[model samples]
Target: MAHVRRDKKKLLTRIRRIAGQVAALERAMETEADCSDVLIQIAATKGAMHALMMEVLAGHLSEHVVAGKTERGRAEEARTIMELLAKYAR
Candidate 1:
């Protein structure tokens, strides 16, 4: 998590932006904005969430999972990673 500390400011900035977007989404719903407009915002929120998850997951796998496993054992981990990636793929 030391690396996270190093990137804390940048991460916080992104999270704050996401929070703002979520608030905007709430506003849009309360105001009964156009259906397409709300859907577009929802899509953007989903993309932002996915990007955040990808960053955290990549860091965790590199720092913890791969670091603890042997080269041979990494193949199984790689396969699992690939499957998860495929599941998330657009």
Candidate 2:
């Protein structure tokens, strides 16, 4: 989305951090780290991913749905957002 372009760097940084968390989780598994440690890493990674998703979702709502030029367009985007939330939300 065009709005993403405005915050591309910030989003990339969040993605990179999430990637690092995943790599750490992989390493923990490879080394047979304690289960608690592995679980903690998993939680951290999931939370980071959720936060990133929320940030982008907010942007989409603001820039695409709320700012849509037509009522129909807004309604369509809102429905898509609801579907995504239903599919992905914890």
Candidate 3:
């Protein structure tokens, strides 16, 4: 997430798409759409969120974890990223 401020618009676009997917999922649930269809929508939303996370993670890895000036800063960034990955994998 290192470049979030610089890439605000891009991140917002990704978030907006995820929001639209969530809305669609809600509509599907309200309409009693097929279980499989709802599952598909859910998967799409999850994918969108995962994609956004990956984008931010890449920036953080390059700009902070790998390129940080101090070893302590880099180690901290790496720890943060590992925690995020652990959560995301679940």
| The candidate that achieves the highest TM-score relative to the unseen native structure | 2
Each prediction's whole-model lDDT (CA)? 0.80, 0.96, 0.92
Between prediction 1 and prediction 3, which has the larger TM-score? 3
Each prediction's number of clashing residue pairs? 0, 0, 0
* Candidate 2, residue 59: lDDT: 96
In the range 1-90, model 1's lDDT, one tens digit per residue, is: 554776778788888889998999999999999999999999999888888778766775776467845776677767777787888786
On a 0 to 1 TM-score scale, where does candidate 1 land against the true structure?
Answer: 0.71
Q: In model 3, where do residues sit more than 4 Å from their true spots?
A: none
Each prediction's TM-score against the native? 0.71, 0.97, 0.93
Q: Candidate 1 — number of clashing residue pairs? A: 0
Worst 10 residues of 1 by lDDT: 60-69
TM-score of 3: 0.93
Error of 3 at 84 (Å): 1.7
Which residue pairs of candidate 2 clash?
A: none
Q: Which prediction has more favorable lDDT, 1 or 3?
A: 3
Q: How accurate locally is residue 5 in candidate 3, as Cα lDDT from 0 to 100?
A: 90
